[model samples]
Target: MKKPVAGDSPASSLSPCEIPKSLLPIFLKHIAAFIDSLNVVVLARLLPQSHHRRILTASTSAVAASLLSQRQHRLVLAISTPLLQPPAASTRPLLPPDNGIKKNVQGPTFMRKIWARDKQEAIQVEFNDLGQPIDEKSSSELAHFLGAIARNGRYAPLHYKNWIKVPQTYKKEMLTQVQEKFQLPPGQEDWILKSITKKWRNWKSFVKTNYYDPNVSLVEQMKNVPERVHEDQWKELVTFWNSDASKRVSDRNKVSRGHQKMVHRKGKMSFARVAEKKKKELGYYPSRSTLFIECYSKGETPGNEVASQAMVQNRVCLKSINDPTQIVAKGIVRSIDPSTEVGGSRLRPNWCEVHIQVAVEWDEELIRRYGMFETIGDALGAHVAWPLFLVERDESDD
Candidate 1:
């Protein structure tokens, strides 16, 4: 059927229906809603026809949550409600745009979006402009300190499998306080602060063990420190420096994660007694470790007795870590060097303390080295390498 077209005139150039410019917003909103394919309701009444949005996308945003910014509210709604409709039958896998994308945003990542929006939003905040770089000595000192830290074995995060967050034992900006107090000019202040931070880092690394050592007294640092204006401030410093509650929390989380990895379906029941388990509560303690060993001959078979005794010997080696593991005195036969003899007993055996006087060879100059027994046990389980008899000296025999 032939239909009559509009006559050639100014009216004809215009769209015949002429969806009004005034109505464009209303129509476009409906279109977006249709494209989104969500249940949308159009409100015609509230703010007169001029300002009214056609389709109010049903938001899950709560009233209180929207106080921060409308964008947050929008994001909550956008995420909570799936925007894309499922493919009818067969299509590419449904994915939100940019599911796995890296963003190199400056400032805080969490606040990046907000800042982008409210860059013009006026608010006053004070910031001490950073001091400029000063003499090369400061820079050199800082560099040296940082390098030393990297070389230090004490702060070995490598020892831990997880990203053990080395507690911020030394603050980078703390030196700024001293610098500022001394009224050193900007350049010098920067240099000094930088230097102090470097020194702190270097010291941490050289120690070979973390600041979390039980024997290292944090409170003692306070004793050496000069008289301070506020004692409370000193206490706070000591509290954090001495006890790395943050790192401890992190270590626990790492252990928890490791434990979560082993989900037993239905597994072996232990024959080891509850008391034994309680007594030697092995594994998953703070910085705790498990060592399993089978020892006989280095090249051939080490007898069961030898392996069994190795467990006790293993305990001795771990003890050295508590002190220093340079020596192993366990199970050595040597003559008493002392001229004086005991009145009651005539024997001073050359045997050293398993932990103390050393007869066994140990090579611990740099990297951690364990005793022969401890090393073997760390490799083999006690059940596999246990000795039948680990004899103790009888008083009667003595």
Candidate 2:
């Protein structure tokens, strides 16, 4: 007769098949070894082909040895009869069937930890002498602060063109609140005030566009006013909207908007964010020309005729400039003082005094480079052709 497997023993007359307590430890050890060897073989398959042969051989040997040892001890017991038999109803306790829902006992602890971490990070943020945070989080926080002020009805009717027209007491209160919350330096008071004023104006415009309807009567429009705004303030806003002066201003703005040739396709993305994204992609901050092209162009082509001409002119200007750094320095100075004349008759205010000096300098340069011009205006107009080059020259000397 064929020999039975070591684990396949005849039924004992005394009791059910149970491993001896003394041999239980040894049985578990062998089972663990067998599992570990199988895991090793699985891992071996993932290794390089050269290492696989050696690793698999060692694991297979271990598996075979563990099986042999287990068989000798009859540790791989098959208690098939017990597995097939059902437990007595009285022996097993009655319990409800499990569904997948679980209680979130650790939720409060997790939220507290998150809050603490955010608080710690906020404390660690650094700021410049100007009170501007060096980190991006502070920018987001400032935006949130401005948004809160914008949403508050107490600071409504931001119709004044100049920030100076706002009440002094209100400005002081806002300044004090900003200083307390953001730790703003005294130097940044003007900047903070301007930012707040701009936000308020924008919020006012948003409310007017989204809530007010000119077709509806003043009373009907008043009903649509935001709950945060007082009824009196809403009536004043409606009165302003219906005024002849406001209508004239609106018509002028529509005319000015129609003259705009280039549309900003970059949407709401700031130039800073665009530069940052480009830096990540290209592994460095892009040059002004590269940034302009990337931002204003679609793929290889310029977005519009104006952008196309600007790029062509920029290339010409880059060639004309002997020292590129001068261009950057002059650009910075021009930005700080928009009244600074830059070799163009753009009819800017405060340009008369600066323009005379600029014209004289350009006249000499134009004569030396491109022969004589008919008049100072002719020389200045010629300078505009190389707009990027002549604009950088220092004409600060009176």
How accurate locally is residue 130 in candidate 2, as Cα lDDT from 0 to 100? 43
lDDT of each: 0.32, 0.46
Write candidate 1's Cα lDDT for 1-398 as tens digits.
Answer: 23446676766566635778889999888876564443221122212232223223324112122121233335445554444332122211112235578554332112222223332442222112344332334433333333333332333222222223433443333433233223344344444445444444434333323223346577554433221112343344445545567468657866976632112221221112221233356543222111111111122222233222332334322122222323322332122222223222332221112222333334322112234334422322211111111212222322
What lDDT score goes with residue 39 in model 1? 24
lDDT (0-100) at residue 304 of candidate 1? 35
> In candidate 2, where is summed lDDT lowest over 10 consecutive residues?
85-94
Candidate 2 residue 103 C-alpha distance from true site, Å: 35
Q: What's the lDDT for candidate 2?
A: 0.46
Candidate 1: segments with Cα more than 4 A from true spot: 1-18, 21-75, 78-322, 332-398
Model 2 misses residue 15 by how many Å?
A: 70
The residue-by-residue lDDT of candidate 2 on 114-158, one tens digit each, is 223332243233445445444456555665575556445555345
Please give the lDDT score at residue 133 for candidate 1. Answer: 30
Best by TM-score: 2
